[model samples]
Target: MELLYNNSTNYFPIYYVKGKVINANIQTYGGSEKMTYGIGLGYYNEKGIFRGTGYNRVDLNSTMNVTPVNRLNVDLRLNASLSNRDRTSGDGTLQSASPVETVPGDPQELSSLLPGEGSVAWNAVLDALKGTKEKNRGVRLRTNFRLGYEPIDGLNISTSLAADYSIDRRNYFQPSYMSDDDYSKSVGETGINLMVLNENLVSYNRTFKEEHMVNFVAGFSYQYDQTEYNGGSAQNAPSDKIYYAPAGMPDLGIQESNGTKETIALKHYQSDMQEKTLLSYFARLEYGFRDKYLVSFSLRRDGSSTFGEDNRWGTFPSVAAGWTFSEESFVKDNLSWLSFGKIRASWGRSGMHFSQNYLALGIMNVGATPYRGQATIEPEWVRGLYNHDLSWEETDQYDFGLDLDLFNHRLGITLDYYYRYTDKLLTTIWLPGIHNGYSSQWRNAGAISNEGIEVMIKYDIFNREDLYWKISVNGARNWNRFEKSYDGKDFGGNIIGKPLNGIYALKTDGFINEQDEMKVFYNQQGVSNYLSNFYKGAFYKPGDYKFVDVNGDGTIGSGDAVYCGSALPIVSGGIVNEFRWKNFDLNMLMAYSLGRHIVNNLSKAVLTNGKYALMTDLNAISFWEKPGDHPDYPKLESDRMNSMWSYVDRDVEKVNYLKLKTLTVGYSFPKKWSRKAGIDELRVFVSGENLFTWTNYSGLDPETVDITSGFDLMSNYPLARKYTLGLTLKF
Candidate 1:
């Protein structure tokens, strides 16, 4: 029997930034006839207001291994975790103010105004934060058990079962003592998820003639998961003292216009649940010859309960091959600096599942229906038609790659090119109103193609006994377009031959000037008639935006709207550098993305329309005020009601940015110093994340785009900049 133990503790204490972490691990190993076991525990705590957020967590894990026979083994593992988090208010209202309200002025002047003692704006925000509170807590538990047997020398078999359970709870409360503009309410939500997975596998590995080797594995898996959520809320509480649901406020009842009075509902509740199951079978084979050539193939068949009976299963297969060029005698003899080189190619097929819970089998929903001019509430099928043959989206991909290592492997580079085509894309088929007024059916009748190239490079600059430095750079470029639609049609703003997230708008030819307002003419139509007929009678004086008539139809209309920009980035990359010298190390990462367009909704919402003119600082803008003022913006007006369509093209702007992702510096004490204190090693580090960003786009941040919707409305919480100083000791 043998025993082993390991432990570590980290502590950081700084003003407005403090954290602590402790971990313990233990293992017991026995001979083949005895059982082995291992256990671990971890605890972490953090508290900081300026740090944007804080959390505390505890984790525990245990594992046991048994070997009852010469060819059989069994292992069991369990893990549990608990965590709680606190976040700062990051909303527009006072109760959720983010970074406080900003006023237009110099930094020095703004600093002179203190909360409560100076400006009213500062005092209001401080009051709101003090009366609002939000909290989130979560718990997770997981367990796995596996049994393995090796009856023969070259063959092995294994079976495993695993289960996971998690629960998350959140509470948000705002007191009546908060500002008058804010609502007084309390809300709580709880979500629970459970999942079970079972798998069985068999593998065989053999080498023949000491030059050729082969390995194969086949597996079958089944997974099932269920999720449920419940929430409760109460609004218009009697006072700050009663913040939870079932708040008492009948004394302050609400009176209706019909001379009736009633108290608000003490508690309102909502709940939802969903379940999914999947079964899959997969196999893989790998072969290598002379340690220089390699080939691999894999296949998987999956069946999901979410799909219709006719299309419930999908097959995926992949094949890859590689050749080591550096292993050739001619190259090895001629170029000693080339340490290693390989070329590889691969082709694969995959499937995707989207947000269609019960689209394949239409659902009967409960809603209010009108019968005999009287509204009656009952259960009925939805208005839209259902498709019983909905299928999974399939994608086929091909890739070619090259890898190189030169100067004794000090420099390494990898390049890859890939093309992917997706067929049977899941989408809705819109139907004319004549059939069922604004109804649509789900179907798999869309196609898209995506291609990209990626390159990665790494080099060791300095390598010595006391100093070492290395740098890594990676970049990628991608292009995607819609290939086909069910009926060769466009939905919403999506168009064929264009990206899925492409924006459509009318082209703008700059603002109209005072001298050209009366002089300009459209096919014998004056400016006044053009504005009156096409612009919904909105007056456009000298400084309004001028649009190009794409159709030359004498008027501006929907037909003039064309593809203006896309939300997909053409290029993105990151650079990382690491340096070590005499027990000290430093690391930095910089990331960049370009060729993506955004609507700049934040600028259009807050910087213009003359709504918050004095309340917030606006972007640098120019307006046409006189005959010769030809500026980018229109004349400043308190109540300008221009057509939203007219500015759709102008609101779009390319977002290109470079950001310093992270910077860290650390130092480790010598072993001798730590050994004297009964410790194996000690390390201290300081790190900063999201230090700065350089961008031409005039929004909150370029990295805030949504992945599924491709929209950045600046409504969510802003990214936070964080700084941490920590020390670790291991024993």
Candidate 2:
């Protein structure tokens, strides 16, 4: 057995709060129960988890909303955090000493005017630490911050700013590194240990709404981020403790010594200063005639930093008209079942920025520029390659909705349907040309449409004998399409049939049936089963799982791939049922999604837990015990690889199932009992999540989906089930 790290430790205080001033002193320590990486910075790379952030600091927040002035609102917020963390570097690299060096950026950009002087060394940092442990000393700080704002309604003006001055040495790890990824352990020490950050954001919000309901807003801001990377490891202690400096002391003068060092990805530290401003003019007008009909029109023009020279500004406008049918003279009192009804419709156009700083303007990457002497890479897109010019991808949507309330508002229902078509899509794909380095330039080469229908219904079930019951259900169905594309224009291919955005791999069929059945089977590549088996001259065998070939070509191939039909239940929604009796209450919320399938991509990994790091704890190996065990899962070395179907052929299934999302049971003590307890009201609740699952999926919970992995159909992160018991009191 190989050991990634074996250790024992104690660390120091990098953070302590003395009144409002928090001081920094770093000392961190720990050993790996399982292999883990040594991060030199506060990395946010989340691997198998939501974010790559290492054990993150627990945050504490409190807010105070105070009315200092009659018409003004003042709000103050304070935040604190306590986190336990440790980081390690490789062994004794500091022995072969290197003198400190300097860089040119400030902690808060406050040093921007001065030629920045920074230091990095094999020994300089080692002297500042105590402990033979391979400690990164980035021990987290207990930080505190305050934000205050005062706002006056009609005047529409407020200033909001945030400061996160951590006593923790400032270093930003790229997002991908701090992820909860399973692979994080193996590559933990791959990046430089660095620190540098004192950032701030301050902004003002101002809006003007007129008597006619015309409203508008405008703003500007700047952001500066700075970092300094110190990749040195320590001495003495252990070989894995790179920052510990082999001698365990900084001033020991162990220079010119030789030792091992685990190389981490030296973070390419670079500072970015972006001065951003948003200029906009907007107006909205609302009019109602005799309170029976209403009309609204609004327009906004915005200029931003992300656009190219010509497309720096985009203008959006919307118009809506509604009719309140119940307000009519003849309809006001005729119907009791229909208390009120409003029919409304609207059309609007919105623009989305591509976000690249120079997306709109042509740019040249100049290398080592002395103006004329600089090497520059020119923009490749020949100007005017397309008939149209640049503009933000535009989405034009039209909506129709009906809002109704019946029987004194006891039964209420709302139905809305919308269709949005987005054109000038700003995305890039490989054009069919090797001349342009295997690709062509970026362009608005296609269009897509998103249309959906939504319905919400609520009813107050009858109440009797001091008990009340209510039920409500809401759901929506949507269809998305790639409306047009240049490639489809010249070919017979169904551009409209572009496969659904993310389809579970092809559904799987059980073991091959009769010999004749095996003959028709095909791999995703469209290779014929008959031809394949004939050449091998094999017949269908029992308990040998099989996959059906959608294409008669008899192979599971890209050619046989088709758009997924009704995936991940196009119709997804939840139902809430509530009942109240005396002083007790019960509520059940059940939600479901059908038509979506999970490829069980991790099947191979899990099946072979015999080899991988995470799967080491699995017990399902050697699945079939004896002759008639007739296990459906195969235990083959080849099956674990690209065999069953490359990452694409899929052994997918229709992930259609219903589940209860949340159920809560609570009890409220009688008012007299609350008074005895000196509380106005008291309640307690018990809740269990993912209490049950009814599905054929063998992997894990069906509710959670992994965002990162897909190419090979591996199982995503397994969602955890939780149970909570809580209490509340009101005075």
Candidate 3:
């Protein structure tokens, strides 16, 4: 039997006060000769840093084993859970009015401002916490059963069946005070999903002459999944109190406006259903000689309903081999200190079928529209252009690795190098302007390649009875590129020969300092000609940014923009250390990343002099103010269009950081003391996460920024420091 409890709290700066978490679990197990059983129950709750946003869940799990016959065995497992999540934190209505837009003022004064109408940041926070509400509640259930029988030595057969089902309901409401139209609204949604799987396997294991061994296994599996969704929204609710129920709203009759009358339905509804299935057959064989040489091979064929009939099935195969040279007589006798050494290699091919259901066939939507002043049902245009030639996306990968252990296993090291290539990438292509009433078509378009090397090392410094210490370090470096495309077109920051998701921007040479300097530069660099050709001959001010002319044509154009950086990290790694003395133990973890860049969009927004508050930092003061004033940013002016400043090198920053990810210390009570209290063992621990960070990036928490777009637009939540205390008990 065992029991556990944990509690933690998160603290942030001015925007958030504190968030709390609570967790508890209980488990017990007992077994006899013929049967064994185990069961567990767990509960979790959290209060988010943002008001009116939190999550709660409860789950139960159980497993049982039975052996009714001499060579037959049966196993059963079941799991069930209920969870609820609050989504008010993601409300776009409040997000659009970000606190950063509020004018600078005292905290107490801001809080006293009028709700919904005030320009104070505190008002938006209050409205988000009280005026709007959204929540999703879900229930999930899963069960599995397996049976195995061994009729003869070195032979076994097994079959298993599993099923999962879940249901979810969401409710959202916004009062009239929170909307621009001064009308209360509500929305209701419900969804259900079900899946089932069945599998059967056969295997035989035997050793030949005690030095050579062979094993073989084969299996067949089938899976099916179905999902159904229905949702509706209603406006003009009677009152804010009538939430989560669309029926509370009433339809409004036709009314004359500008000599026109139109009927309006208070509620609008929509529904969707999707289903998919997969079937597969797989087999694998393994062989070994004297435990020093090993080889294995596997193959599988899978068929999916998401693909077209011509490409419904795909075949994948893999092979691996390993050799332990340390087991040879030469190493055993000559290199006695080398306890272990192995070299391994493998290669594999895989397929992906992730498109939406029924994408290979045309689809039509039905809706209601006004016809001759009367409501009529009509068929809308096709959802998307369909093509029956679509096939599965495939990836081929190869790996080679070496493992070594020295000093009686006190030091260990592992190194690996791998290359992966993917073709027939599943993506959407935009058609030429509303072709056949459709804007886009799904297609397999391009090829990409990735090559990387990873290394890991671990060492034991002290292995004494009372004191033990170990340290491990691991790191990886990868390079990714777009190898080929159908039309030789560049999109989404991917270039033909450059790294994927590269950042392209114009180079700048600080701000224009003086009018005389600008005049002399324009004459020599042809800035006047370039502006006239590209920017309608917009005149540049002394405080404006001066772009570089890379082509020496004396004008800056779109072609002058060059590749600056990439969104993907070139190197990333982590380090872990563990130590124990007597009954006390300690662990520390650190993580780092390099060669990634981010565009500080938040800085651009604040410096644009729009309807946003200014940042109270030294960077904000570095804007050019007058002639002869050299500055890092352009002059704070909103009257003219500054297109050159939109994408410039000034906004891109290299984000290299080393963070102390976690640290923990714990002590275990002596067994005698625990036994006196009717307990088998007990332990207590304290841990801290995100405690320290070292970085040159200007953004708040570089690790939390968006990796895909590499833009820090202030939409992501900042990482919070956390402290946790926990206890474990067993009997």
Tell me, by lDDT, which candidate is best: 3
Model 3 Cα shift for residue 706 (angstroms): 1.7
Worst 10 residues of 3 by lDDT: 2-11
How does model 2 fare in lDDT? 0.49
Model 3 deviation from the true structure expressed as Cα RMSD, one decimal place: 7.1
Best by TM-score: 3
> Which run of 10 residues does model 1 get worst, by summed lDDT?
6-15
Give Cα distance to truth, residue 345, candidate 2, Å.
1.4
Q: Give the per-residue lDDT of model 2 (tens digit) for 569-593.
A: 5677888999998777888888877
Q: Clashing residue pairs in candidate 1, if any?
A: none
lDDT of 2 at 605: 48
What TM-score would you give candidate 3 relative to the actual structure? 0.89
Model 3: lDDT of residue 11: 13
Error of 2 at 320 (Å): 2.1
Report the C-alpha lDDT of model 1 over 220-320, residue by residue, as the tens digit.
99998898888766667656766565634332334354666555454566788888888999999999998789999999999887778898899999999
lDDT of each: 0.72, 0.49, 0.76
Each model's number of backbone clashes? 0, 72, 1
Off by over 4 Å in 1: 1-38, 44-54, 87-125, 177-184, 235-238, 246-266, 369-384, 434-438, 515-528, 531-536, 607-616, 638-641, 644-651, 705-712
Model 3 misplaced stretches (Cα beyond 4 Å): 1-15, 88-128, 246-248, 253-263, 367-383, 432-437, 514-534, 549-558, 609-620, 626-628
